[model samples]
Target chain A: MSNEVEETNSLKLVTPGHASSETEGRSVDAGPGDADCSPDGRVPYMMSQIQETLQTLDTAVDTILGKVEELHSKYEREGLAENPVLDACREITFACCFHDLCSQRLNIVLKSLEEFGDELTDGSNGTREEASILASVGESETRSATQDVQGGGSLLNGPAMTGEGLSQEDVDELLKSFEEFN
Target chain B: MAVDKNMPVLIVDDYSSMLRIIRNLLFELGFKNITEATDGREALKKLNRDAYGLIISDWNMEPMSGYDLLVAVRKDEQMKKTPFIMVTAESKVENVVAAREAGVDNYIIKPFNGATLKQKMKRVIGDF
Candidate 1:
C-alpha cells in the first residue's frame, strides 16, 4: 500500500511535465509569441506592417507615374498630342493623381497610429501620467485630422471636390449666379 | 473674344500629380506659357508676382481652398479680372452656387477629358 502511495506521488510529480509540454506546444504555435505578449514588440510590428503597405502603395504610384510619362512622351514625339488617344491618356494621368492624394491621407493615418502605438508601449511612467500623455496625443491627432478634413489653409476641400461632373442645369445655374455676382 | 493661347496660365493643385496632369492638358491645348503652384497660398503669391491670363485651380487644397482663392482673387483689384476656372469634384448645387457667387469665370468637374476642358476654357475665355 505504501509502495502504491509512493508510485502515485511520482506520477503526480511527472504530471507537471505534461503541463510544461503543453505550454511548449502553445508557445510553438504562437511563433514569436513574445510579440503578442509585449505591447512594445506588437506596436512596432504593426507599424512595420503599415510601412510595408505604404511602400507597396508608393511603388504602385511610381509605376503609374513612369508609365504615364512614357506614354506622354511617346504621344508628344509622334505629334499625336491632339489625338483622342492622347486625350484618354490625359484622363488616365489625372486619375493617377488619386495615388498622391491617397498617399497624403494615408500618411496622416499612419502618423496617428504611430503616436497611439508609442503611447501604448510607453511603460516608463505611471498609469495616470500615461493617461495624460495619451490624452494630449489624442487632442493633437484630432486637431490634425480636423485640419486635414477642413483643407486647412488651402482653397480646396478633400475628395468632396472630386464629385461627379456638373449637369447642364448646374452650369446654367452657375452662369446665372455669375451674372448676379457681376 | 478669342483666348490668347499664348497667355500665361496658372495651374494650382496640392498634388504634384494633379499639377502635372493639368500642365500636360494645358500643353496639349497649345497653352505655351504656364505656371504651377501646389497650393492656394503659392498660387496667390504667383498671382501677385505675375499677370496670369487665366487661373485653373483645384477646389480642395490645404492652407487655402480654391473657393477662398477665388474670393481673394475677386477681391484684388488687379487679379479680379483674371479668368478663374475652379476644377472640382463637387457637383452639389450649393457649391456651384457658392463658386458663382465668388465670381469664378468657369467650373470643371473631375475626371474630365481634354475636350471637356477645352470646351470649358472656350466658354470662359472664348474660343482658344
Candidate 2:
C-alpha cells in the first residue's frame, strides 16, 4: 500500500549537521543491514528538517512574545492599564458605555469590524456607510446598557435606537411617564 | 402643571457605561431624581421599594428583559399605568409592534441627539 511508503518517508529522520556532530557519540546508522541500502541515511536527513522547522517555529513564537511584551510596555508608558480592546470589554460591565471612542483606539475592534463588514457584503465590498451604521447601533446599545447600570436602574432601561414605528397609545404611555419624570 | 420634580425616574440597562451616559444625559435635561437597575428583576425590586414617575428600559437583557419588566410594571397594583418607554436596538417592525402592544409610552431610535431626547421627553411630560 502507498501508506507504507508514506509512513516510511514520514519516519525518515534527518538530523542537522551540527546536531549530528553533537550526537556523534551515538552511532545513528549502526544497523548492519542498512549497509545494502545507502546506510538508511533517510532517518537522519528527515530529523534535520524537522529540527530546523521546530527552530523556526520557536523563533517565531519568541518574536511574537517579545512583540506582546513591547506592546504592554507601550501601554504602561502611555499610562493605560491595558490595551484598548481589553479596556473596552472590561468597560462593558463597568465603564465607558460609548464604545465608539474606545474602538477608535483598538485595532482589534477595527479589524473585527472590517472582517464583519466584509462578511456582510459577501465580499462585494463598498459598504462603508452600512458598516458605520451597524457599528453605531452596536455602540448605542452598549452605551445604553452602561448608562442604565450606572444610574442604579436595571439594564433594561437604557436608551436604544433602531428604525421602528411607534403607536399612539405607546407614545401616550411614555408621555405620561415623562409627565411624572418632569 | 409641572410633574413633581422630586418624583423619581427609574432607568435600567445591562451596561454600566450606558447607565452613566443616560443618567448624565437625564440630569443635564433637568431630571434630578433618578434611580437605576441592571436588569428587570432588579428594577422590580426597586419598584417595589419606591414610586417612580417614569421607566425607561432596554428591550433585550439577561436575567429578565425590558419586556419582562414592562409586563411586571403593568401588572403591579401601585406601578400599573406608570409611564414606560421601550428604548431598544431591536428596530425590527415586529419588535416595535410588540413593545406597542405591551404598552410602551414612546420609542426613540438610538444615536439620538439631545434635542430629540428632549423632544421625546417634552412629549411625554406634556408640560415641556
Candidate 3:
C-alpha cells in the first residue's frame, strides 16, 4: 500500500486502489492545503509539515540503503569481487557436492544391477558368488560428510606412496629376481 | 576362499566425501558390486530388501548407530552370519573390544588408504 501523503503532509492511508492517479501527491489545482505548491514546481518551506516530510523521506532512503548494503555484503562473501579465498571455498563446496553425486550414482548402478541380476531366478549366478564369503563374523551400521586425514593406525604409516615409476635398474633387478623365483 | 569381485557389498556412512573415499578405495581393490547407505537405519532397510556379501560400516550415525546395528544384525537369524567390518575413527580400546565381542569381523581406523582397506578386506572376506 502506498502511503499517500496528501496535499498537506499529514500522513494518511489512501483507500488503496481507489485513489485517483493524479491525486497521489498533487491535485490539478492548488487548494488551501497545497499552499506550498502553488501551480509551480518549486517546493515551499511549509515549516512543521516540511520537516515531517523530510524525516519520512530520510527514513525511507535509509531502509532502502540498508537492504542494498545487505545484498552487497552477501555478494561480497559469495566472491562477487573475485576473491581467491572465497573462490577456493566455493570450489571445495562444489567438490563435496560432486562427491555426493558420484556416490549416489554408484548406489543407483548397484540397485539396478541387483534388480537385473535377481539372484533367486535364472541367471542369478551372474551376480552371485560362493556362499562362504557372505558368512558373518559379526554385524553392524552408518554415512556423511570427510576432512581429517589422520593416520589412525599403522596401515597408513608404512610408506609414502609415489606415483613416479621406479628407476630402470630397480625394475630390471626386481623382474630378474621374480624370474629367478619362477 | 577366493573373494568374488561381483560380491554385493554394502558400505554405510553419513558423510558423502567419506562415502566416496571408501567407495573409490573399494573400486581400486576390484569390488564392483557396492551399495551405499547414510546410516544404520537406512542400511537395515536395504539389508532387508536384499542380500549383501559384506558390510563396511562406520560407528557413529543417527537414529540407529553402527554398534546398535551390529547388535541387531547379530540377533537376526537371517543376517547374523554376514561379515561386518567397522571402518571408523572411533579408535578407543574399549570400543574395539566391544566391537570384537559383538562379533565384528574386522575394524579399520579412519584415514586409511586403498592398501589399508585391502588388508582389512583380506582379513575379513579373504583375498580379492
Interface RMSD measured for model 1: 5.2
TM of each candidate vs. truth: 0.64, 0.45, 0.43
Give the lDDT of residue A26 in candidate 2: 34
lDDT of each residue in A1-182, candidate 1, tens digit only: 11111122123222111222322222222211332436555556556656766777767766776787788789889987587866667667777766655665566667767776666656445574776677677756644221343343322233443444466456766677667776
User: Candidate 2 falls in which docking quality class?
Assistant: incorrect
Model 1, B65-98: lDDT tens digits are 7877888899999989999998765556656767
Over 4 Å off in model 3, which ranges?
A1-182
lDDT by residue for model 3 (A9-76), tens: 45332322233344444332222244433422122222233344445544554454345445544766
lDDT of 3: 0.56
* Model 2 TM: 0.45
User: What range of 10 consecutive residues in model 3 chain B has the weakest lDDT sum?
Assistant: B88-97
A1-182: candidate 2 lDDT, tens digit per residue: 11111112323322223222222333232221222223234333333444455455445544543454455446656877656843443323222323322322233334454545444554345466766676667756755432343244333322323333433345445556655775
DockQ-wise, the better of 1 and 3 is: 1
